[model samples]
Target: MEKERNITSMIAAGLLALAAVVGAPERALAADGAALLAANCLSCHSAQGGSISRVEGQRKTPEGWQMTITRMQEQHGAKVSAEDKRRLIKYLADTRGLAPAETAGWRYLLEHDNNRVETIDGRYRDMCARCHSGARFALQRRSEDEWKLLMHTHIGLNPTLEFHSLARDRQWFPLAVNEVAPALARDFALDARAWKAWQAAPRTALDGSWRIAGFLPGKGAFEGRMRASAAGEDRYELAIEGRYADGALLSGRGVATVYTGYEWRGSVDIDGVALRQVMAADARGERMHGRQHFADSRRMGGALSALREGAAPMVMAVMPAQLRRGETAELTVVGSGLAGAVSLGKGVRVLEVVSRSPDRVVVRARAEGRDGLNDVAVGSARGKGLLAVYGRVARVEVEPANAIARVGGPGDAQMQKVGVAYRAIGWAAGRDGKAGTADDLRLGYLPARWSIEAADEEAEKAHDADFVGHIGADGVFVPGDAGPNPARPKSLGNTGRVNVVATVEAAGATVEGRGKLDVAVPDFVQRALD
Candidate 1:
């Protein structure tokens, strides 16, 4: 009987893998979006018209497409390479991006990287924003029926989603279908006329030189210039040259693909390390702003911007993005025409101007312990810079507030463990009650030790660790076997809730924060629609 159960588990596991693959991204690895979809995906998601009929007339941001691709891979089992995924995302975003007129008021949120919390209204706030960022909802256009289908997909896949702490107090599904879906469709509905006009609009000719300014944390600030020549329609060959804060000359070059009419995606090498660029050109195509990060370690990067030749002075970046309170340090500021004495903003006092030039400036400064993240300004500058002055972390917050993990079944290699990301959100208490408010100081990302344990004594008595497996310092929670465990009453299967904790040391004190994690048997395949 044990052997038979093992064989059955293996079959179930295989089926789950197949299901996930079916939902994954396409596998054609082609640059032609239509051709790629027709060759690989049309076998299942048939194309009735010129495009994949199901996705016809829909528009979303690059991130939304990425989420769609991820769901496809996780739930349906689509297989595609990373490069192919990028190409596909670029294609989709370009073909289905929000029109400029469609995104008028919201573009500010995209160009700026502020930590301000986004506000959403009504049942949608309780039902949707709790799971995804408000930006996700803001950057898409869909018809009413399409929106309804999305709601159905959520309900069908994660039935207990509404029961999660964030939504447990409300009638989630009913409210979502009756109110939320209609509201979203009404507010963000597809502007077919606008999309058509944008498609026919004159494309930006990104051929020539542009001044570039940007910051890379830990590396300081850099001011550079980039020259682009047309490679093809909506594509360009890029060459870059710059100097760091310490007067080190830097050079690199690569190719870029423009999407959504203005969005720019580039693959380049910086000082021999692979880097990816995600920036968007302004409506006039003269100014571009966004960010770039190393392909390997995404955390090690910063903001970037470029301006057309002869344009006004634009500040690109400030190196070492933030300052530690009560500490003195040298700051490198990078931008165009950045002459004259620099201002270090509030909570920071400039001790001396070590050096100054058109593109770079180094200043000796100290930060006051009480100040939070502050914007640094240059006297009569065209663009603003940023800095953070923070002291020891007063508290840590576990993002998402809750998470889920799953146990692997016997003979199912893929189900061995579910990885969970435990990020430490450090906070210095503010005069206001909230940690994210203007007065409260945010310490940003901080290092931490991670662990998991039963949420209650009953779970402890059951020896839940024997079944729930363990979590690693990297924040991944691996679960035990799927079958009933011999550790508890009738071995209540390998399922339960546990606490995920993060411990950090600040100001010679230990700070600990926790989030709830649910461990359960693999439910990769939806049994039935809710």
Candidate 2:
């Protein structure tokens, strides 16, 4: 516990130091949207014939647009005040943002999912994924001509792209211009009925109470509430409070700005820990979903969802999302208008109602029977993708089955090792009663005994586990000391691959989940987006 507090304090202190030196204004003046854009973009972009080139008939998420504007500033020498930049991006996104449906599959790019791998078809994968995430391609709207030009722009920017192994096999430029551009234009066109329909729909309201449910990596699952009241046009002040399943208090206050009537970006400070929310409100504003993470680290984050207080009786989330067979446990249900008798899902029965309210219910449940994806409910409100009940744990799976951990460089005085927080998930065999089958089901996060080992046969002869890192019982793996360890063979640095193992005991038997962790050197160059 003291070690954990020291780590937290170090991170907080580093952030406070950075915050103090950033030298940004205390507050920004309201920007004139029309003037800022025309003055900043029209010069090099050219508004000849009454339309600025590459600006019309295009739409993107706020981050997408923000990236574009940032590229302009960095590469094209475009200058705009930070405050004006925010206003311009806001204006562009509000008027030309992606509809909720358009951003469905590409949200990971914005949410900063570290383990996502692009699975595009061979051709486009060859053309795009070689350079950046495929999601960066999916999160935009453009005309066919603009997409074609985009191909040219890419080749112009990175002339050697055609020389890469993936592109060298074919006529890279022609294939990109002829096939990839047209295909993307079809799939992500600027003009869409969905965007039009969204424009015509009523905007979701912001002032109200919200039930919050999420898992904080290294902290476990939590349920909370937030009060959002309008602060100004398109802005809100948020008051947050909640607790982890283990009874740890989760409290915070933050401010948010709603973009495109649905995108919710908020900065929150919980007990001195800063977190940022990258979520989207439903069209009705009744529910919000996405990830929230540390302000300084993107990979260290977790999924979050919320429901408005006054909405219809709707089951949004259940803490301790999984139930174990033949065992009884306390379950907390959080949602809007949650009242009446509770159904703890298949194989589970409510032994007692500990408490009840319109937005929460506490119940003691007895779970039994075979594994199944269970449905939780509060009377008529049924929870989906929220609860699972399983007999004895058949298997355990650790997320990011493969990951990379970094040891701080010798120059890194603080030895800021890049740690990875892992959680063990229990699973059960499907109806086929077979492990590792396609139908096997997840039973959610579970307690486990964590350990490390050699990654594979070749690694068995290595001293990676001895010199690389140590993982705590809390599932956080902190890398070994920086610089050469004099005791190592030839004073080698701590760098190698190790297997992270989570052992879970079920029915007096142990099931282990293994993941590969590559301990490597730290990155010196960093950026906010990275």
Query: Which residue pairs clash in candidate 2?
Result: none
Q: Give stretches of model 1 more than 4 Å off.
A: 1-96, 100-185, 192-229, 238-254, 267-281, 284-311, 316-321, 334-337, 352-362, 369-373, 378-385, 390-392, 399-423, 432-438, 446-504, 515-530
Q: What's the lDDT for candidate 2?
A: 0.80
* TM-score of structure candidate 2: 0.87
Clashes of each: 18, 0
Worst 10 residues of 2 by lDDT: 23-32
* Alpha-carbon shift of residue 516 in model 2 (angstroms): 2.9
Model 2, residue 141: what's the lDDT?
91
Q: What tens-digit string does per-residue lDDT give for candidate 1 at 1-530?
A: 64344444444543454455553432221224644444445444644433465577578877667777777776788886786677668778877777776766554344333223566775566778787656667778988878888888888988888779777887877777888888888888886677778878877766678888766544545778888888764678999998875678889989987778787778888789787777778767888878776654343356678887655665556665567777888887766677666777777889988888776678899988465566666655544436667766667887535766666657765444443445676777786655556666666656678877788897788767656778666554567777777666886887887888889876678998888777777745522210
The Cα local distance difference test for each model comes to 0.69, 0.80
Weakest ten-residue segment in model 1 by summed lDDT: 23-32
TM-score of each: 0.55, 0.87
| lDDT (Cα, tens digit) per residue for candidate 2, span 400-508 | 6888888874555444677787889888888888888989888888888899998877566667888898998978888887778887778888888899999998778
In terms of lDDT, the best-performing candidate is 2
